[model samples]
Target: MPLKACKMFSNPTSAPKAPSRYCQKTLHLLENFKTLVVMGDEPDREILKMVARTTIRTKLYEALADQLTDIVVNSVLCIRKPEEAIDLFMVEIMHMRHKFDVEGLVLDHGSRHPDMKRRAENCFILTCNVSLEYEKRIFLLKCRAEGGNGCSLKASGR
Candidate 1:
């Protein structure tokens, strides 16, 4: 796919509409930022939210905030050096003439994967756990891949 420059965008698969099934399937509860901001002043928002959400882990919650905060920093950096973002949108057309150096499935939409709940366009995924080549080091502790392709990654260490 051709790379198109944008002023801002983090999710290549971000939907065009609200209450998207694709998004809801990935997340338990999706709320507009406006809704969170509207409950202003009298009470603290983060504490109230954490109390209401019994299952959310403190570290994970903080991570999300950290990621959102990064958008601003990233955006400024990208704007200053936009040429770096050209590799952000990726797609492939396979044939005998040209081929990917690595073996991996490239699908047009996220929903094309059996495990995904809904469709997404221009999605981008990155994995840093294992490199392009096979892993060389052996794990001292028992560890296994969390999920197959077309699924969410869920891994933990004991």
Candidate 2:
């Protein structure tokens, strides 16, 4: 369940056959997963470094993305910084958005990348924490609540 094993990657038009030992190991790790893999080619080396750093720190993201297929089938992926790396993740989602059932996204705080907001129009943008989780739960409840077209979210016991 390492970041390298998450299989998050980008597909270049003409990638070198024999990549570096590190890239090769990362690629092999990524191929073993079934979730959406997000990556780009321009910053291949940087991304590799990030993955290495993440593996050294913790494998939470990789593990979550790997087993996230069980949560909502489709997902609402939120990448902290998606400026130059936006397209990499976008392309991956575009390819599988139809095959799977990606509902939307909630880009939380700490993302200073400007383009992230503009480019991420494809998904929802959630800026608040409490509101974000509340909205997510409401969305799920709405999905499950049959004939719930005009449901209200006012505070209870008002």
Candidate 3:
């Protein structure tokens, strides 16, 4: 069988559905992580959260049950080359809470253009790197502690 077919058989749970703009990419990311997770064995809590947020948001969008992801995607895509600060993004996402749930967010911090770096840095300053394991856990706990906390599940569609 072909590699893609083999993978589909091996990891049916993470397979992407057709007519999905993100399905194939999501499954590919999961497969790549599956390999990396076992070697060196350090869990990238941030990345896992990123994937989860991406998956959930994408599904939420495709399902059209909520417009949260659509708003975030629009805002981020609208930002020029670099990007705006995380808080700005969060605020934008927060504004759409009436349309969807914002339970937890995972900001992507990979290096890129100056604008991208600025965006990530701003996120760090805003959330104090809450996407990081320890801080992220605290953020989750605090959200749960509160009744209607809006968490930004940050992830780049790239």
Which candidate number maximizes TM-score?
Answer: 3
Candidate 2 per-residue C-alpha lDDT over 36-70 given as tens digits, one digit per residue, 9 for 90 to 100:
54554433434444444444334345555344333
As a TM-score, model 1 comes out at 0.16
Q: After superposition, how far is residue 112 of candidate 3 from its true place, in Å?
A: 48
Would you estimate the TM-scores of all the predictions?
0.16, 0.15, 0.19
- Per-model C-alpha lDDT, please? 0.39, 0.42, 0.43
Which regions of candidate 2 are displaced past 4 Å? 1-19, 36-158
Kindly list the per-residue Cα lDDT of model 3 for residues 1-158, writing each as its tens digit.
34455454553455454324354566677777674432123334445444445665544443442334444444443432443322443443223325554444434454455555433433543334334221112222223446675555433332
Query: Per-residue lDDT for 28-60 in model 1, tens only?
Result: 333333244333333443644444342323324
TM-score, structure 3 vs. true: 0.19
**Better by TM-score, candidate 3 or 1:** 3
Candidates in descending lDDT order = 3, 2, 1
Select the stronger candidate by lDDT from 1 and 3.
Answer: 3
Choose 2 or 3, whichever is better by TM-score: 3
Model 2: which ten-residue window has the lowest total lDDT? Answer: 133-142
